[model samples]
Target: MSSVDATPIGAGAKARGAGGRRPIGLLLVAAPVALVLGLIIWPVALSVFDTLTVHGPQGLEFSLEAYRFFFTDGFSLRNLWLTIRVAAICTVLLLVISLPIALYLRFSETRLAGYIQALALFPLFVPSILLAYALIRTLGPNGTVDTLLVAAGLPKMPTPYLTPWGPIIGLVWDNLPLTLLIVLAGLANVSRASIEAARDVGAGSLTILWHIILPRIRGTLLVAASFVILGLFSAFTLPYLLGPAAPEMMGPFMRRTIIEVDDPVQARTQAVVTFALCAVFALFYVRSVARSRREQTS
Candidate 1:
């Protein structure tokens, strides 16, 4: 009698074994995820809890004092509004400056590509606070820029250092390179064949850019803008060093609340509010990424 193929059964058993090992592989991944969750969840949850309860001069107590302080507190809304405004301004400036540079890097075949990339990232290597100091020395009273202006028969201009504009300028300088890098990476994935096709179809450069490149890279643009917004919003060093005597950032205020005012609870509240605002933007960014991936796959 001819034996039915036992070899087929053996092959099927091997395939089943491979499939069974996948769970073990997944279990391995879960360990690091669990570690991260363990580290992050507690602090975040505690802050949220703290935001609900009150810690009066007497001690910690269950009350809405923190939120009350945030809402009824003078200048809180003004500072929050200013923070949002600054973030919006920084996002616009970053995009306007970085996008054209990114496009040039992607479309140009010049050898200066390496030089340009290095130059773009050079600011990133410098620390924010250090950059602030450097800017001050170059543009502050009797600084290089002022001396140059005087030599050129121009009056010495007032230094912008340690002012509202100081932090804004510093934030842009610090974050511009990173924004450019992200946009450039996105532009790299634009289909060259598709661009050429558009050109063949009598599409002008502007039309091709407007229709083909922008739509394809919209996700990247959003991601870059989100990063700039979040970075500027949470910025500490540059704003602390370069901004006015009382900068309107949650960072500086949180420090004052905690250290100078000796109110840990208020500081925690500010931290949570700032984090929550940024978290909302982060969630949108993640959603955009997911949608972009789905579109690409479909």
Candidate 2:
């Protein structure tokens, strides 16, 4: 201590310590980032490679053979069509149901609106697999729903389980929360003054909805639709359990091709195709968000 070098040794030591720790800090940050990139990038790369390569006459070569086989042989086309059909129908039905609920929540001070909201959001907490099984138990043929119907002297309706409508029903229930939340958020941004002015001029409810509400909520609609479409395109669990064997959705088709048909390369190629379709909608969703942000800032 008496000899201390008398040159602000403590400050210099602290500076050197911080400099040493800098690389450690950087490593801590980079490690997770590297892991995430490795997880996402590697599988995607493998899928693309599988999609573009074929065991051709030359042992291995790049070609569109996989894609041609998928499209022309109608293996992928049928699944793609079914996926689109279910997704489209669910989207339309959700919009039809969610719109009035949103409008009611916007204007009403009633407790019923609160209960409706709680019920609508209930499915968010239920896992899809559990819900799938629960639906089969409650609504399947000879299950609780049919029993009740028969007891009431009404014939039991056809079992929706293991049918297209079965998955459709489950998907609609699961997707309701998504669509409702979007519609409510869009409704929140609507100017109360404009709505009031329209009402003061004797504009009917449907007219106000058409001329005022619909235009403002267009972006929200796009966001909701994109989310639903993306989800349905990759739908696995619900449709897998409830849907029929023949006209399967893309998710089941992909898995069946891998496990049953023993075609990992083809399955991965199908996955690549599904993701590419989702990408188009994802780009539109991004653009819609960017435009909404710009409008708000401007």
Candidate 3:
């Protein structure tokens, strides 16, 4: 009699099933992938091409005149510098404000933790335009804050409204929910046993935090910073409404370049430069994610 086949029927069927599903999976995602390529990738590629090439006496030759002008122009340079500065400050502030809250949410079991978390996430539900108007009413000249100060027999402190600080404050508030969520997710990965063991050895809160918690979440912090910086770099509404008339953030600056100055080339160049800067941070974020995944798998 012929010997029966050694291969298990179930294993063969399973392998065939998986192979069959691959096409279906690809088919399901094909539309979205195509949309992304068509909508986002194509436009960005065209914009970059437009920014790099110009109609010269010799024809459509490559030129950096727009970029050179952006770098050399005093107003453009100031706006770029201000955008960078504001992004840096907001990133730092988000870290400082979010980390502690994340830590508390991660470690605490009290009923108040829920309330605090809800409060932290409240900004997510609020629209940016509404938030901007609320900020104006609450912090603008002779607004709620000034009125309170006057009533309390104290000098009215300088309002952040309509200044560099305005965007900083608005950005920090707008971005807090996302930053806190990222930090909390990072904190979730910390081993409770490790924290408890450190505590058993008489490690104080700060010591444990410094030696244990911060090290574990360093990658997460970098990812959060990358996202915040990227968003702030491209931010328009907050910076436009709240920022100064002169030396505004890149968003308003780009808008004004397009509408007021009517310089599409300059605007495109600025966008390209901004994209390059954001790409650096985006790469960092991707590497951090990849490294974290590798560590988890290994």
Candidate 4:
């Protein structure tokens, strides 16, 4: 009988096993990683390329002229400031409003807790355009708000639509669901025993919340705030329908630059600027999530 080559069988088995794992790993990890990288990197790369390149006497030359336009133009500067202001205001408001509601839901076992939670999430179910239109109908001239006042035989106030406050209100409404969900999730992780123990020791609700609940979920609040800032800074739909034309938010400003003014390069430059500002809040959100996970793991 011919001597069989045992090495071939063993080596073939090893090769098959390794080959199988390679494909599986590629499917499980590599594909999704590639998808995410494409989603993130492509837009950023395009924005940077467009922003930094300009039609020169030669062919295309790299310049910071797009950024310079933003700095030099009064409207662009005001638009940037408006975005920053809106983000800051919305973040603070969400913290104030969502935190208490989250805490209440955390502690409540009443019949209405579910209803309240559902109500808080109502904005998420509604389409943003629909919501924006609803806001316009409520705040526009002789719209629902004024009509209700007229029906009540009261003086109709000036229309608040097409103003900063119109979009601000819409943003607040849209952002509430996300804020509530984050805070509520954080509250879920709080030790019920710890809270009850504090209660047993005669700690008041305010004291328990301030000392216990707040400390426990501070990271989560920061995460929520970061997300709110990111969303509000790059907001498009709400700002488009509701905001004023003079001092546009970054989203509408970039849009108008492209469509109305026919300046795609400038629009992309504004996009890069918006992305840079949002990166700060994105970093904070990442760090907050990392810290929360590390704490949980420990």
lDDT of 3 by residue, 212-246 (tens): 99999899899899989999999999999988998
Q: Candidate 4 lDDT (Cα, whole model)?
A: 0.82
Predicted candidate 4 versus true structure: per-residue lDDT over 1-298, tens digit per residue: 0122112133344445556746664455555457767997887797798888888999999999988987898888899998898888878888899888888887888979888988998998998899999987888889998999999999998776888888888999999988888788777768899999999999998999899888987887887888789888779999998889868899888888899999888888888888888898888876776665566569
Q: Work out the TM-score per prediction.
A: 0.86, 0.85, 0.92, 0.86
When summed lDDT is taken over every stretch of 10 residues in candidate 2, the lowest stretch is: 1-10
Model 2 agreement with the true structure over 1-298: per-residue lDDT tens digits:
1111212223344445556656765565465557767997787998898789878787879899888888887757888888889989988888889888877877778999888888988999999999999999998989999999999999998999988999999999998887787778778877889999999999998999999989988888887788788888888999999998868999999999999999988898788888888999888787887787678669
Candidate no. 4 TM-score:
0.86
| Local accuracy of candidate 1 as per-residue lDDT tens digits, 160-236 | 78767778888888998888878887887787899999999999989998999999778888888877887877788
lDDT of 2 at 116: 84
Best TM-score goes to which candidate?
3
Global lDDT of model 2: 0.83
Q: Return whichever of 1 and 3 wins on TM-score.
A: 3
The local distance difference test score of each candidate is 0.79, 0.83, 0.87, 0.82
Compute the lDDT of residue 137 as modeled in candidate 4: 85
Report clash pairs, candidate 3.
Answer: none
Angstrom error at residue 242, model 3: 0.9
Say which candidate scores most in lDDT. 3
